[model samples]
Target: MNPPSLSFRARARLSRSAGALLLATAGLASLAGCANYAGIRSDKQPLDVARIDTAQSLPTQGGQWPTMNWAADFGDTQLSSLIAEALANNPSIAEARARLDRAAAYAAGADARRYPRVDGHYSVKRELYSGNALYPEPYGGSWYTENNASLSASYELDLWGKNSAGLAQAISEQRASAAEEQESRLALATSVAQQYNALAREYALFDVAQAEARERQALGQISAARFSAGLDTQVETRVSDTQIATSNTLVSQLQGSITVMRYQLGALLGKGPDRGLAIARPQMQPLPVSALPDNVPANLLSRRPDIVAARWRIDAATQGVTIGKADFYPDINLSAAAGFDAFGFGHFLQFGSRQIQVGPAIDLPIFDAGALRARLKDRYATFDTAVATYNDTLVRALTEVATQIAQIRSIEQQQHDAQAAYDAAAKAYQLAVIRYQGGLSTQLQVLDADRALLQQRQTLVTLASQRRDQQIGLIKALGGGFDSAPPPRRDALDAMTSPT
Candidate 1:
């Protein structure tokens, strides 16, 4: 009455079919239990550079971008050398480089995750077998030496692109770090230049102060002669002596400022203050005509190191969002372990003592109590923040360039008037001195004209310094000669709305 038994081949085929059905059911269950990530996404949109208007602020004529050796253009070899030294030795640059190296290390680790991992382990121990345990006969209640050796391997199935996304995110971060390093270099260079320019201005002003003191001394001699001749009172001679003292005080103040400026330069060079003393006075060339490049905001994204760094951070955040979404799916890994084990060392290497294991491990986020959702939401928020930061940086960059341009134009107009005033004051001082020598004017009149001339000279010096400073500002605003390829036109919206 019993049914006929199936052949070996038929039994094997049925076993295969049953195994397939089981796997299919498990897969469906895993998919059904996946954490929900619906309705969570970044909302911010990056600003489109093409849409922003900059017609009035930027000049229409085409101009060249700043060269890599732009500091050399200032005609100060010392400035160029100082910038080179700062770039090499500055702590800020070193910190940025360290960040870049760390990011690269992280990227390498992520890349390693995409491939299979293998590990080997070996152990030796002395153990006691219990009589009530699985050990048989004399083996029970005996102490023996046990040996174990194993080689295990595992590979994650990135069906959800988790590992790949992580690698991409790390790469973006590395790129951002690199751009940040460049930014630090640019900042240091410009700072050194501005400080050097200030030192030069102080030196020029010091020369004028010394000249004024000499003129005051001469006037004092003349006033003394007039008093002796009974043509002027002691009051004029005392006034001339006070004027000379004031001029000398100004010279002393300038000397102190020059010393402090040198100290600052030495610090920028990553050396002692004495290094700055070795720095000769900067012989800055005439300011080049200020103009804008043919490309404005559109190309500025790539030209400016800060903006480029911001764009890379956006890419990194996008990848982070992708990684968060992937966390909602099942993490499947295939693992295999083969090893030899024996109660005693004598038989540990025997074929009969060998064992092997192979299986797929699944980690499904079935009941994480909304942890996965929270993480994904955080990622989306980070993405939104990055997009907003990038937009803000772009807007600020444009405004900076425009503000520098406007200031430069204003300075140009002032320089012309300043030159004329200086000429007129020089002529008036000459006439006053001539009249005083001819006894047609009082010594006070000559002193007044000299004061006016000194004022005009100082004004001209300040205007010239300001014009140079504005030129440097404009150069920095235009990206300080840094250049790179444009980032892809993707933004937060593209990342948030993409299919999970």
Candidate 2:
């Protein structure tokens, strides 16, 4: 085969085309600033997921994760109903729903640019003519009418993919909005659970306080009797009375705390604070210790709704950078109008009343005092911000899971050891009473043992309350266990064929 070379004219034309190509390439390459921003999809932990504790990841799914009623762990029907009601009616959820709609509408509007737009306009006008104007000599200052009817249409050529970029940004934002709504719902549900757990703890503490007060009074009475019988000194009675006063104060304080917790719980239920007083106290149902999923770090990044929303925002920002760069080129649009127009009424609908006009409009970025460049810079910075925020969110989530897991583990041990201490104190109180009755121990000694037993019992109650709260905390850290709704079907074909 023979080798062929370009002639003189072809070579010159080719050089111009190559120059234009280089200019366009340079413009787009400026937008490659997108490469500087970190991606949200990479599972590699930021600062090692902030050194997350591996012991308490969320539970692994054997099947699809359940429609997790996390509050059910407490075995309380009232609590369950409260959670369900809050999800159905909370104001925050309503606001999130409205935001989702707004974002979807914005996305739909952006999609409109993918097609042509047509509009119909009609107008009738009557105006008085000046005597010196045309036909004024024949009919002085007479009124004349004009009529116009037209169909005007316009479509963008999308030479730079600007319209598509806008649509992509909008869709990414809409996905982010949906994720935000999920997060809000999860937060509301977890808030109700936390308050409900708090109410339970307060009630348990109240019971312990009441029992301790009762035991303290009994000891005070024993101390009084011993002092009168010359079996104990005035110092013993003073110590007993002081102990009783302290116990009484604690009982009052616990009563106040319980009332406050009830008020807060009622408010969370969207009821009056007075309603809090009317609600029944939760029973001492045992909360089971839960196991974290083996893939704690990765599971949190993939499953947490907040994390998902953050990732979506990063995508939106990336598309925004593209949109900003696209503005550096010319915008091309095609418009057409066809219509009937006339000065005379009868002839307005007849023959040459019809007219048509069509053309293309082009807008080139000639000069802007560096405005476009500044805007592009801002878009890149915004993308950087989104990436930083996403990494920070992952870090905090890991820290929270670790902190909650550590607390739960520590509280469980405290619970076991406190129960044993209470048991030992109870036996000691019994032996002291027996010895005092046989005159082997003083009445003061018996009173002291009784006081010690009450303290240990209170300590055990405190541990129980802590365990319950931490268990709820652990569940919340795991994203409230809401099943992930499937990602919206992309329908690439349908999306292409029907932008609207």
Candidate 3:
């Protein structure tokens, strides 16, 4: 037997052979399960958001652009109050705010993974074991209880940037959500202001309708006097009656409109119809007239909340693509565990019962029939959608601003023409009334002048309302009411502590 023993070098060679055999098996398994990339394509084109150019000057628009809190520029406390209420209680805004909270939580969860993770584990068990003397049908059995407790820790190597890419994507989404919340606030505030403007407009029209009714009554009284004295024709009397009826109808219709608008304002304030009924006519304020700079700043696009949110979404999608590609590489994780275990309770804490384990694990994604490639394709598609969305948002935002500038210009010219017409007609009506009272002009002539005056005054009212509407429209289109959000921690923390 001693003569047949092999040398140490021969044993070393045999061990090397066994290792080679294991490696060969691994290679064969990889080949057998490998994925094909024949139809899969990698789209690596550089991404960009479209830049829509716009001319910056309009004849009728003047005064520098309205500053933030533009509703205050109108100097209507009621309007400011409505906007504040909407921002606080609008359901849509609350939903968006909730979304921001969810995104912030996701961001924190993702970031937490950058460091190591530790966990505690414990277990208790009772087992029966056979002690074999002859190992017959019913061998002697003994019962024993075991207790174990352990602490385990693990961390990822992040060798190929997979974890970092995931973290980046999550953070980008959080920022995007914050921007979306800003957009929501801006939209709600603008909506409240527009509704308030509508209420003001209705009140102005109601006043004009009442004035027309008064003029109609005066004319009707003169007609009745002439008819009773047999100095007026029946046709003239009928015409006066018809005109009076028409004026009353207009006045009633205007009152109805005013009622409806007040209700609408109440709803925008997150209140009920009764709240609107308590409101009075808006104190007239100077029309909002603002001019933008000729050269739109490069950062102007970035300032728009929607555009900013869209860009962040694109960034998040890009990181998603990175994460998908990273899946093709091997992932390495290091783990460790230390604990105590014993068959009996008394010795559970003894040195001989101690246990510890430490090691590294490697996962190779060498198989799966095109699953990884398919996932990568899906990610690329998401990225494409994000880019398209961003482009569309940018173009729309720029268009809104440009169209508003032109609209304000045209409305200003109309206001000028209407004021001139009102002045001329008013003078004519005053002179005609004086002449008739002095018995120097016919009743029919005085009535004609008064009707003309009413028409011109109504035209002025309509123009003023139109200017107010356009002014608010332009301000909203320019995103003039909101600023950047407060720091994320303050907002996110508040959301976390908010009641369910």
Query: Compared with the true structure, what per-residue lDDT tens digits does model 1 show for residues 1-500?
Result: 11234569866876775586459547855574456788776668888888898877765668778877988888889888888988898898899889989999999999999999999888999988898899986988989998988888999889889899999999899889888888888898899889888988998898889989998888888888888888888898889889989999999999999999999999998999999999998798866778889868777989999999999988888889899988877777878777888988789888777766666666777778889889988888888888888889999999999999889889888989989999999999999987876678998899899999999999888888888888888889988999998667775566677655
Off by over 4 Å in 2: 1-67, 133-140, 217-249, 483-500
The count of backbone overlaps in candidate 3 is 0
lDDT of 2 by residue, 1-500 (tens): 11133469866776776576557656654554433222211212123443655543433423222246767767888888888877777788889999999999999999998899998888999878788866645465787788988888999878778889899989989988988898898788878877877778777777777777777677677778778888778997898788778878988888898899888877777778897788787864767665565666766665678887877777787677777766766666778777888986898766578766665665666557767767777776777677688789887887777788779879888888888888899999989977875668976788778768877876876787777777777776777774444333232223222211
What is residue 56's positional error in candidate 2, in angstroms?
10
For each candidate, the alpha-carbon lDDT, in order, equals: 0.85, 0.72, 0.71
TM-score of each: 0.93, 0.80, 0.82
Best by lDDT: 1
The CA root-mean-square deviation of candidate 3, after full C-alpha superposition on the true structure, stands at: 9.2
Q: After superposition, how far is residue 13 of candidate 1 from its true place, in Å?
A: 11
Best TM-score among the predictions, by candidate number: 1
Please give the distance, in angstroms, between residue 35's alpha carbon in candidate 1 and its true position after superposition.
Answer: 2.0
Give the per-residue lDDT digits (tens) of candidate 3, residues 101-127.
Answer: 999999898888888999888899986
lDDT of 3: 0.71
